[model samples]
Target: MAARVVSPTGRGFLLLDSHPAGCFRSVTDMVAQIPPKAGSQDRKVALVIGSSAGYGLAATLAGLVRHGIDGVGVAFERPPGRRTGTAGWYRTIATAAVAEEAGSDFTFLNADAFADTTKDEVLDLLEKRFGKLDLLVYSVAAPRRTDPRSGTTYQSVIKPLGAAHTTRTLEFDADGTPALRDVTATPAGEDEAADTVRVMGGEDWSRWVTALADRGLLREGFRTVALSYIGSSLTSAIYRDGTIGAAKVHLERTAEELDERLRPIGGRALTSVNGAAVTQASTAIPGIALYVSVLHAVLGDALQSPVEQSVQLWEQLTGAAPLDLDEQGRLRLDRWELDPAVQAAVAERWRAITPETIAEVADVAWFRAQFRGLYGFDVPGVDYSEPIDPDLDWPAPR
Candidate 1:
């Protein structure tokens, strides 16, 4: 389709252009005015991969709103469907609009992060446009990948550790009632785990940095970070201790390697161990909803939400004395993972609470509403009376 301007209903602008180059440039210009940090690097630029939604989008928004970063976001997903507001899309538009009103600079690149061509295109653009980037956030998560070298496609599957087991879980539609659901764990072979490593692991991260650095697209003393999670032991068998855990181990290792690679330029690769939040990716995992439900009940009592964790993450990246390790010298965020008090509390609650007691113990109602909100199912202020246009433009950029 020929490039045409579409005014977003609430805030930003959308170009209904099929050509990736023009679309990318337009979005980049829209958000390019964000101010740079004082007494630091001059002309700092950030590139956020997987910036369409989730943690990536959150980080991008925080960079602009909280840190005064002028940067570009590379997203892979389409804009929200009419009435179905994707939170990440909404946040992006809102952020861009605010940045524009404040005369900040920001940009958006919508493309597949896994494609080598996409990487090269981004690097070229960075070279031509920003010249160098001071920060890079790698947050792309894909279920499958086609190996460029071997031409082999690999798909990742989520399964519990050990044998098949049936667990009682809450069905949101069933009046918050407990129902027993049969769950099976697929035993992934070593090759399968290796393939998962090849796909979702850190190789792509290394490639992007190497390409950007070789092109002189990275500024000296720059920092690159990727977000990872290690949930509690109850779910570790399926996450950190399972097949996915294997992949994460490889990813952590890659971060160490990248750290060394970036050392010469004073660039550093950091891996942030983040707390759990609701996302399209997290919902499909086994037993996560229930755990999140319990967490909401316990944490919400203190008026804390998952967004608090996100804010903490942003502070760590941009703060004057950003969060460092605990007494043990490991990352405090990871220490937050292994905190004895937090672990004890969660484990005790997990054992004490059942599906029947879920509504009573945890804020099942709140969690359900939040889950629905993720998919634009149950937002409070949104008007459902009007017919939602699935293609409604996001109101963000001016």
Candidate 2:
């Protein structure tokens, strides 16, 4: 018997192209798009926890190129069976390569952000080299975490409370047609919720902040932010009101405490409520893919990617505009995603969705394309037909 091969799947095992040019080209192009500003260069150094890809990578790159801030990133990713790991690994390598060409620091440590070992590494690096960090961005999306202090690992679950929640899930067929499957996830247990909170909640984020403060590695006026999402009412049952939502609520509360802790030093902690998109993490959710499908169709060109969203957040932070927050206190960056017109239009498509209308009403083609792009399959200017050595020689900063 030979080792089993893992291939792409729209709903099943989603395959990713090993093409390197697409991943590198996509980010370098975006970095060159931003013109440097005079005062933006004031932010000298930043630490991005969980900065492998998605919003974290975009934010790190945006900070480095757009604002001239050098970066240190933390992530834990290993290659698949015989292939390179998630696209993030390659993305980080590509980002570091770009930064190298520009002669900027783009250090990376492949270790669990929740572990004391990784924190110790950050402390040493900051003390020996950068001295202090002007910004800290926490964007880890993990299903499990081990307490650095207690050494006990916790796993998070996504399940409804009280009763089983049944919802529609979207998967693409071999011919790339959208197929709907009814999925009814079991209700979460009481202890499971606690574990979910323990893993996905703000403990690690708060820990990172306090550790930096303790080590005096945080610069004056340092700012830290974490990401969150509260989508429309359609996903409340599985998202904002579910077990993961409980963790987010705790995460928001922790941000309040962190804000208070940093206020005296002129630093601030914020949780940015973002829009939904296809990600390795979001695909596990029962209804988010379907929601995003309908959302993309309704919003059309108005939809923004993680990079665009991170750029918006960066703009808001560095600008003179007063900080805006919802009644619940998290920063509102999903206004377009949750716009009344967008949601209403999405709802109409949601109700109209059926096996036959998946292509017409929901834009399944667009959905599948985006998913493929996440792993470097659908990007332009890349020749995928050629063989690729997934073993990219990433610079080991550790």
Q: lDDT values of the candidates? A: 0.62, 0.79
Instruction: Please estimate how well model 2 matches the true structure, expressed as its whole-model Cα lDDT.
Output: 0.79
Q: List CA RMSD, all candidates.
A: 7.3, 2.9
Strongest candidate by lDDT: 2
lDDT of 1 by residue, 16-88 (tens): 2122222223234323433344454333478888875566766665566556667677766566433233445
TM-score of 2: 0.93
Candidate 2 displacement at residue 200 in angstroms: 0.6
Which ten residues in a row are the worst by lDDT in model 2? Answer: 1-10
lDDT of 2 by residue, 1-398 (tens): 12233245434635643345556766776576554644534556788898776678778777766666676888887754455566777778887876676567769887889998899988888878788888888998898998967888898999987788999889877877679989998999999999999998999999889889999988888888899888989888988889999999999999999999998889889999988877777877888888988998888877877777777777766653456688877888799898898899999999998888877888777877777777777776777665555656666773
Residue pairs in clash, model 2: 8-14, 8-15, 9-13, 9-14, 9-15
Segments of candidate 2 deviating more than 4 angstroms: 1-13, 16-18, 29-40
Residue 253 CA displacement from its true place in model 2, Å: 0.2
